[model samples]
Target chain A: MEILSLNQISPDQVVLLQWGVVRITATLLYTWVVMAILILVAILVGRKATADTAISRWQNLLEVVVSSIREQIREISQDEPDHYTAFIGTLFLFIGLSNLLLIVPGYVAPTSSLTTTAALAVCVFFAVPIYGISKNGLAYFKEYFQPTFIFFPFHVMGEFTRTLALMIRLFGNIMSHDKVIAILLAVTPLFFPIVMHALGLLIGMVQAYIFSILAMVYIASVTQAHESHGRGP
Target chain B: MHIDWFVFAAQIINFLILVALLKYFLYDRIVKAMDARQAGIASRMEEAERLRQEAGRHLQEMEEKKRQLDARVQEILNQAVRDAGAEKERLLALANEEAQESRRRWKETLAREREAFYDRLRLTSGEIIFSTIRRILGDMADAALEEHVVDTFVGRIRGMDEQAQELLRRSLDDSRSEVTLVSAFELRPDQQEKILSALGPFLSHDVTLRCEVRPELISGIELVSQGYRLAWSVQRHLETLEEAFKEALREELPEVNLENAGGEDAPAQEGSRQPHQSG
Candidate 1:
């Protein structure tokens, strides 16, 4: 009745390029579609934004999303409400829009794939420490090994665990929500699919909030800890 | 599940692109709006504080002007009272002088009348004596004897009038003073009678007694006459000493502001000076 598994679409012949002991698989066409759709939405929203006149419908909706995300960012990043606004706001919008792609007929939700969530988590892992370092240079690194010399291992382990947690949480939630909706749709083409879709929207929003909140908390913990250590915010 | 390298690579590229686009475009503008809102709220709060300070300054100015006006009004009233008292004293002196002059004129008229009456009495006595002697011995030489008898009788009458005038002067002296005795003690009727009996020897005038119940005296009595107070109370002496100390402190520390007026940290007693007492 229904396909057992979802298949990945390839546009061209599978080509492998070897250069400098690096093998690169070219899936430019698939990635390009994802990029193009997101860019078109951004351009549409940006074009509708007005300095003087009332905001257009599409822009107004985007503004609400951006403002709500900005609020959470400020709350989580209590030490410097201004600092983490841009990063967390972008995280929320990208994740939200990516989750919304599941409602489309053909396109798979890009965030439901483990690669997408892991990549976002990796960015957060690097960005948080970089902000801490830039804000407080050598001292931020020293704080990771604080309390005692022996607690350094515990702190190091905490960092990896945080990254791993963020990665798994986002991946598990988004994929499960999408998979449940897909299963319900396969069963019936009736009123029940509507319920699953509504649930998907809810889960989509919650996942977006959770991901951005984790990013804010990570960045905030570093900066706040530095500040508590008598350093710059 | 096994990972597909192609799909994973594609997804990673897509994620980066999405982050880049959202960060560059959407987040920046949103943050700017939020910052603008925050700044607007902060400036508004500052404006409110400025307004409150301005209002406080204005209120202080108004209060200062009101105090000055009140002081000026009180000074004017005191000046008016002094002027009225001076005027009254001047009028009273003038009235006393007129009364003195009138009394001098009355005394002179009374002396003249008495002199005239004596002269007439001497003439009458002479006439009467001459008629009687002419009827009996028939001589005008008896007029000298009549004059001697009249002079002796007039001297006796003058002595009696002088004694009556001395008595009137003594009664006037007794009626001039108003004696009011204010006594404070927790004395029973029997104790009050005893105190009155003891005081009777000291007082020369008729005393009007006013007895008061004063629990604070503890064990002793107080007597107030005119502006003078004679108290046998330890509490009164202590209070007097306290007042003297306060006066000394006031002089030594003239700029040591009294606790209440506008100080927030003033003690309750310093702020509220109205004392409550029981009967």
Candidate 2:
């Protein structure tokens, strides 16, 4: 008999394979599953896409999703969305898809694991500087010393803290929802877990939006810092 | 919460791969199609605007051409009217000239006919008057009348003006030709002696006296010396009376222009004289 408990907060506890220190956990497996699902849908829908006014519903849906992401990126960054669409759009889709799949029986979202959240947050952490440097060159570091060098250390610490905050915010929200639903099922074992599952869906979508939006804000700050500074308040 | 380094690394790699794949398949293709659709819409709008402007220009040109044609039509009509008026005036002038020429020719014809009538009347009147006179004189002829005609000749010589007498005297002195006396009847010996005694005053010297009978003289006598002649006759008196009647007729009918009457009167005058000459 399998015993269910709330002690297992992440899918990492389940190891699918072990090769002498090379171990594949449930998080990695589910991540591959999500990736495969996204890639397959993209390929299928892209195959028949056309620029004509009359289009398939699937193409229309895909176009709506893409243009919405681009519009959001443009609004946040105050610049063209082309440079950041791939990175920002993928982050939203991956996390959004993982959270949406929560409705499936026995399915574990990859975002529920601390490792996946940390990985996404780490990616955003590095993307900010990379986009900023591409726009402003080495001069991107000058933002640290802005308003006098006295705040330099605080500015440096701000970067690491923000990255940690991004990871914990997504992981805690999704994992707690999952853990609460498990507890509710074990305790009430009735319609209450269903209601929490519904709540979990809302929280899941919000987390995805917040994560992507925060990432864009960070990126725009660096990419457009020179322009903002040139405007003189 | 425990973090697994391997899982974290693998998830990052997965996300990066996902980004690359979705960009290639979805974002890039969709964005390209949308941009192309927008460009096509803009081009069609521009083409529509150009066609509209071209249509407007063509309409304006057609209107202009129609206006010009209307003006041209009006001008042509005006010219036709002017030409018609000029033609009407020209025809009227031509008609007037023809009427004037016709009137002139008609007047000329009437004048010619009138002159011919007048000439015939004069000739007829002269013939009748002379024929009557000749018959009367012929009925009265006798030896007593012949003696009286000689005595009348003698009286005419005695009644001559000084100028006439002087002219007869000069002619008798200048000529040595015979003095000839012609009479309508044969004179008795006493009658010849009477004519000789009547001419004695005009003769400056003795000349031969010749008496000739010429019935053409009617009831008259003539004395001839060289080219000079003295005559008294009824034919002369009748010719003078005819000329006076012609003058009176011409004055009465003034519209008859008698300037050319003289040429037409010659034959009539000669015809009138023939009866007397034969008589």
Candidate 3:
């Protein structure tokens, strides 16, 4: 078994299976592993979950994680968490889990891949409009042409740039953390790599929070446009 | 730095699938359970509040009942006290009235006893004095005294007032029976004739003269004609003296006749002192 090296910029470059045009990369394999772990834990803990005050430790932990995510969503959006809890919670869970798993030997973090980060950013980009339209109907698109027609292209460009920034930010931070930790491991191969790996964990969790919060902000700007517009220039 | 489009699309699909799975298995169930638990807690709190209020009301009702019972007890006690006081007063009044009646009866008995003592004293003293005087007069009486008594009687008949003479005359005229002369001593025939001759001027018609001797006269002489009588007797003089002594005794000891002083006994006592006459 070959360990994933710092030289590989993304897990996507490592192909696990190959066909004519269907190449199953390490990114997809690791993503599937993370997904399976999340699903399996959810099923196991959720099945035994009770409304009673006495709950299993696993159920308690899961509730804490889910509720914390809901709270964060509520705070960022300044709205009820129910509408955004699923998408936002999944993003944080998947990214946070993937980043946390970086401590394992030979484990390829899916979020370290440009493809996964881009995919998550794209979801956020599309979800913002979907949530906005659900909340404000077709009027949500009118925000793009606000103030005058002269600022229309700029608003459109700002949307694409923000989406691109969301992708690049998560990808760059996680990839850089992995690279730095791998480089330090190679250079010192001792106590220093442990510290960097610990730092990497912190950076990874912070990135997950940042990514989810940014997505929420973007979605809230569209969904709560009237409130923002009412606040004035 | 190149993005794998297939991997990107697959990752997006994987995330969307995860979102759906988590939403179904985790978020919905947890939120529902929390809501159900909150609702149960709220209802339990409501029930507790209701029970507390009912208990408060029951406590208040009990206190009110206790207050009413206390008031009733006080009222009954007061009424009993009032009744006891009334009974005490009534008993006291009865006792007072009985004591007054007893005192009145005692005074009446004392007065009755005193009146009886005085009557006995008056009767005994009058009997003693009159019996003594009669004994003295009887011891002194003789034929010569009888002769003087007949002469005095004849003189009294001759010295009678006109009214007395007229009353004697009317009595003699109305008499169908004998006119009698009686003496304590034997009267001589001449002396008797002298007494009858002195009474002759008062006679309206010829009436029979009967001579009788009575020792109870005690050295005195008497003449009787139906409803009219003339007497000269030491017994009469003694009776007048007894009456005078009784008047003096009544003046000296007012209490002796205090019981009958102004009553029916007074007039009857006064009538007893009148001269002996029959209509």
Best candidate, lDDT? 3
Question: Judged by TM-score, which candidate is best?
Answer: 3
Q: Which pairs in model 2 have colliding backbones?
A: none
Clashing pairs in 3: none
Work out the TM-score per prediction. 0.46, 0.57, 0.59
- What is the C-alpha lDDT profile of model 2 across A80-145, one tens digit per residue? 999999999999999999999988877888999999999999999999999988988888888888
Whole-model alpha-carbon lDDT for candidate 1:
0.60
Off by over 4 Å in 2: A1-5, A187-192, A230-233, B55-279
Model 2 vs. true fold: TM: 0.57
Rank the candidate models, highest DockQ first: 2, 3, 1
DockQ of 3: 0.52
* Candidate 3: count of backbone clashes, pairs at least 3 residues apart or interchain: 0
Report the lDDT tens digits of candidate 3 across residue range B131-222. 78878898998888888888888888888778777877887787886888878987888987888788788776777678888886678887
The TM-score measured for candidate 3 stands at 0.59
DockQ of all candidates, in order?
0.14, 0.53, 0.52
**Candidate structures ordered by lDDT, highest first:** 3, 2, 1
In order, what fnat does every candidate score? 0.32, 0.75, 0.73
User: lDDT by residue for model 1 over B121-172, one digit each (tens)?
Assistant: 5445544543343334323213343233223322322333444334323432
Alpha-carbon lDDT of model 3: 0.82
